[model samples]
Target: METMHKGSAGLVSAPSLREQARKVIRGLVITGQMQPDQLYSVPRLAAELGVSATPVREALLDLEREGLLEAERNRGFRVVSLSLNELNDIFAVRLLLEVPSVGDIAQGGLSDRQLDELHQLAEATRQTADTGNLIAFLDTDLKFHVQLIATLGNQYLAKLVETLRDRVRLQGFASGESPRDFLKQSANEHFKLLDYIAKQDRSGAEATIRRHLERSRGVWGSRHNTTQAAKASVLDESS
Candidate 1:
C-alpha cells in the first residue's frame, strides 16, 4: 500500500510513455495502491507519474479495456473490484489453459541452459517472497512462469496466461497460515514444479500446477468479508 511517486525507482520503465504509464498504473492496481471506490482524475495521476495527460488518458483507457478500471462520465476512473465468483471463473479458466500446456512442456523437456536461467528466476522469486517484498515477488514470479510457458512454443497461450495473471488481485490472504509461511511455501512450489519438468514427469508437472493454482486461489482469493477487510486496511493506511 506504499505510494509510488514520480521518480520512484519502483516505477516500471518502458520504451514509450504510454506503456510506462500503463505498467506502473497496472502495478498499482494489482498491489492495491489504487482503490475501487475512488475516482482518480487523469491530470492528478499524470502529475504523480510525471507523465503527460495524453498518455495517462490512453493508459487508463487501455486498463478499462483490460477490465481493471471503469470510466465515469464527467469524472475519472475507478478500479474494478472482482467478485468471488469472477475470481473462481478466472482460476477455472487458468486451470484449463495452464495445466495441459505445462504438462506438454514437461513432456518435451527443457535444455540445461534454459533450466539454469529459469532456476535463477525461481531463486529470485523465492528470495523476494522470503523477504516479504510482495511487489518484487510478483514481478519475479511472473517472469518465471511466463518464461517457462514461452518454452512451449505457443506465444498466444503464453500471452493469454500473462493477461490472466495480471488480472488477479492478491488481497494478501493467508487462510489459516501466517503470511510469511504461506508465501514461502508457494515460492518453494516453483522449485518442485521445475524438478517435475526436468524429469519429464508429465503427471507430476500437471498435478503440481493444479495444486499451485488451487492453493493460490484459496489464499489470494479469500471470502468476500476478508476482501472487504483487506480493502479497509489499505484505505486506513492511505488515510
Candidate 2:
C-alpha cells in the first residue's frame, strides 16, 4: 500500500522534528548532499527526511532568504550560485562591519567567567580541528565569532552581520579542503584576539580581526576561476 525506502532501515528521530529537518537540510545544502546550482525539490527532500514537504519547504525558504537558495524562474528554488567575486565581496563587507565591533568587545570587557569560557572554547576548537571533525569544527567556528561579537552589546550590528553569514559558509564547505584546517587557523586567531581584548588593546583587536577576514578572503578568491569552480567548488550536480 505504501512506497518503501531502502534506507527505511535507518532510524528516524521524530520528536524534535523541525529542528532535525533543518539540520538535515542545512547540511545537505552546506555540505553538498544536494546538488548545487540545481533546483532542489521540497517534495524530494520531504521524502528523504520521512516527513511531509511543509517543513522542508519552510527550511528551503529560510535558507533562500539566508542567500543559500534563490527563487527560481517558474517555481521552487535553486541553490544560489555564488561567483568568487560575490563571495569575496560578502567577506569584504563582513570585515568592514565586524572589525570595528571588536573595539566594543574590548571596551565592554569580559568577566572572569566569560574569559575562561572563551579560552575553553578556543581550545575545543583546536582539538576538534586536530581530530579532523570538520562539521563540528564549523559549528564551533561560527559560534565563537558570533558569540564574541554578541558580547559587544551591539545587537543591531550582530544581527546585521549574521544576515549574510551563510555566504562564506557555503564557499568554505564546498571548498575541497576540510573546514578543520580553517578552523585550526581560526582557533589560533581566537587566542590572539582574546589576548588583545584582555589587555584592552582595542586597536590591536580590530586590526587582527580585519587581517583574519582578509586572509580568508584570499583563500576563497582562489576558487573563483570558472574552470576551477567547476572542479573545485560545486558540491552536487545531478545530471
RMSD of 2: 5.2
lDDT of each: 0.80, 0.69
For candidate 2, the clash count comes to 1
Which 10-residue window of candidate 2 scores lowest in summed lDDT? 1-10
Badly placed stretches (over 4 Å) of model 1 are: 1-15, 170-178, 228-239
Candidate 2: list runs displaced more than 4 Å.
1-15, 73-75, 175-179, 226-239
CA RMSD, predictions in order: 4.8, 5.2
Please write out the lDDT profile of model 2 over residues 1-239, one tens digit for every residue.
Answer: 12223232122767666666665665555554444545656676677677877766777777777777776755667666677677867887897788878877887678888888888878888888888766566567666777787787777877777665656656444535665666678779989999999998899989888888877676556544543557654555643
